[model samples]
Target: MKMDYEQNAKIFKALSDSSRLKIIDILSCGEKCACDILEYFDFTQPTLSHHMKVLSDCGLVEVRKEGLWNYYSLDINNCNKLTLFMMNLVTETKDCICKNKSNCTCK
Candidate 1:
């Protein structure tokens, strides 16, 4: 399968921040309410909201609302896709980009 390079890059950019990385790690266990997530960080609610928005925009996070509360979780499918893409990118696999280059010296 062909990789969406632009989308993958965007996803990578989303994970560039330490705060967002920690947020992703936190959501790995299971879905969490916004309040519960805030307990682990010293940032303001608006800051956390900004982080969540970035994660959600990148498709790495899933969010739902009930009443006045918002719950967030990892979007497992997209996360798995990223893992597979990274593996393909690093390994000398059949899909390696260099394979298509006729002048590639590392056969």
Candidate 2:
């Protein structure tokens, strides 16, 4: 399947932050409450909420509201799509002059 560069760029941009990456790492184990996720960092609740917004907006995470708390989990399908996109980028066949210029095998 063809990848949407614009949407994928959003995912990459969202993952660029260290805090956000950490959030992803936290979610990797399982779904977590917003309060539980906040415990791993020193940032304020608002800051964490902002990070969650970026992640969910990019389709990298999913959120559910229960009473006063929010639950979050990694969107595995989207994450798999991202993995495939990256793999395709490197694995796809392409002809390049570097094959002859530098004795590379990318021909």
Q: How many residue pairs clash in each candidate at the backbone level? A: 0, 0
lDDT per model vs. reference: 0.93, 0.89
Tens digits of per-residue lDDT, candidate 1, 1-107, equal: 67789999999999999999999999999999999999999999999999999999999999999999999999999999999888877777776777789987655
| Per-model C-alpha RMSD | 1.0, 4.4
Candidate 2 Cα outliers beyond 4 Å, as residue runs: 94-107
Q: Kindly provide the TM-score of model 2 when superposed on the true structure, using C-alpha atoms.
A: 0.85
Backbone clashes in candidate 2 total 0
Error of 2 at 95 (Å): 12
Candidate 1 local distance difference test against the native: 0.93
Write model 2 residue lDDT over 7-107, tens digit each, in one string: 98889999999999999999999999999999999999999999999999999999999999999999999999999888766674443334445667564
What lDDT is reached at residue 24 by model 2?
A: 96
Candidate 1 collision pairs: none
